[model samples]
Target chain A: MEISYRDMITVLHGMGFGVLFMLAFSGAIGVIYATAVVGPHWPRSKWDNAMFRFYLISMAALAWLATISGAYIIYPWYRAVPPAGTADLSTYPRALLLSNPHTAGWHDVGMEWKEHIAWFTPIAMTMVAYVFIKYGPRLALHRQMRNAVLGFTAVAFFSTAVAGLFGAFLNKYAPVRGGPDIVLMREN
Target chain B: MSVEQQPTGSGAAAILAAGMGSLALGVFAFAGDAVPALGRAFTFWQPTGALSGVTITAIAVWLISWFVLSRRWASRDVRLGPVNAAAFAMLAAALLLTFPPVMDALQGK
Candidate 1:
């Protein structure tokens, strides 16, 4: 098995960070809902509270890592302009998609929307983490604050879902490929 | 602090600041996409193009606003009704502004 450097990084960005972050949402929402909605009946000791805070903070960190890597690392490669009159545009994912009318929307709508909307995830998630950490069990006492936290969490999930969906489809249509091949194994 | 003694101001500040940050990002992104000059100006890093500046600036706006608001409201209990309304409105606007179709329609494209 072998994989190129670019492909490896792309997979890490989307699968490692992005998908992991999305998967964490279910546990996060469940715990948060239990704490806020179920109120004092949730059976959270100090240890449980500490663990939940750590989980939320980690989610926020994952969100930051995903978007940062996408924007700074993978995006530059994806948007790299091909050399003049280049026959092969495979190295430039953005250009490859734009060059064909059938796939142009993938770049126009998919990339443009994904790149920008994905950012909302980190911003909203950070707030959700901070608010939850600050209020904890007390959140149930403040109905408005609890509502705001829940609302932002839902929005963050929606933003992430949109970005993740587009990312998967974009890669399917015009993948970011080309780099030094790293061989994993060779048949004798 | 007990649950009754805990103030809501700090949480409110964080919420409002997030909304502000979201709005800042949407506005910067929309402007960068619609205006060539602004787009070029926002290119702080050549490799990443305008995105580098847009995200960094929005983060700065978020953190700064959060710090300022937190400092001012840390111990006080502020009315959340108006704050929640304003923050949610901005959040909705940010969502709409970042959508390409909405942006295109507003730009008459």
Candidate 2:
């Protein structure tokens, strides 16, 4: 079936919005798991550790949401009046991909936003600093709590990296493996 | 200080293992035939972009760090101190540099 630019744009927008919702949904679910369902059963040390990490997770989630939101807006603007085809040819695949409508679109927008999620390392780092400021120097801080913090941080770090590859996979075969530009140029 | 103390080496080793595992998974996800199916867990659609070497490196680092920190062997327990702090800062800087505002200035975005 032929897809219109408008229709393709809609699908792209829907996918982008879906990811945003996923981020929100996952963030909320994680918090709920940490709080209502499992918070009470957790040891005090774990609770404190989790609470500390939770703030960081929340911050990182917001950062991701913001980036995706930014792309969702900026991308359209970029597409609407993209750089004129100087017809200049070069080797920068990344640059080429960015300028090419065939490669760059709402789908690309979604993929690119996912790609940038790794940017939250600073937030995570800042979070670590916050933990140190609030809980550090107190040598007697619960060992279990400390370990829990370490574990949570480790998990968060692990996930960030894992998510990167996951994002890559989606980008590599978007709209089906090696599919033509039919999806991009298809009319409604 | 106690015998029950976690060997720092083990932690680092664990991190390393995690990194390797992720790398392998990524290789399959990006290059292997089953990539399409595996990629579905993360997204409804598959990715068509190139695999990122930088991201792979980051995954390796995390894995190595975990392996070193979580190991039970002769403890090399490195504290999540200045080093990790510094690393995080650098990653953040790289991220900000890629933002559209920054890209615009550099590429005239």
Best-fitting candidate, scored by TM-score: 1
CA shift of A33, model 1, Å: 1.2
TM-score of 1: 0.97
Among residues 3 or more apart in sequence or in different chains, the pairs in candidate 1 whose N, CA or C atoms overlap within 3 Å are none
- lDDT string, candidate 1, A1-188, tens digits: 89999999999999999999999999988887786667754535777788889999999999999999999999999999999999898888999999999999988888998999999999999999999888887887788887888888889999988888999999998898988998989978
- What overall lDDT goes with each candidate model? 0.90, 0.39
Task: Note the DockQ of each predicted structure.
Answer: 0.64, 0.07
For candidate 1, the TM-score of chain A alone relative to the native chain A: 0.96
Model 1 off-target regions past 4 Å?
A: A41-43, B1-4
* lDDT: worst 10-residue window of model 2 chain A: A172-181
Worst 10-residue lDDT window for candidate 2 chain B reads B44-53
- Residue B107 local lDDT, model 1: 85
Please write out the lDDT profile of model 2 over residues B27-84, one tens digit for every residue: 3333322344443443422232222333444445554554454544434545444333
Please write out the lDDT profile of model 2 over residues A1-188, one tens digit for every residue.
Answer: 55534334434433553344334444433432353334333324655555545655554554445334333432332223224564632322244456568765433444443444433332343333343333432312334334433543454454355444444443353321111335434455
Best by lDDT: 1
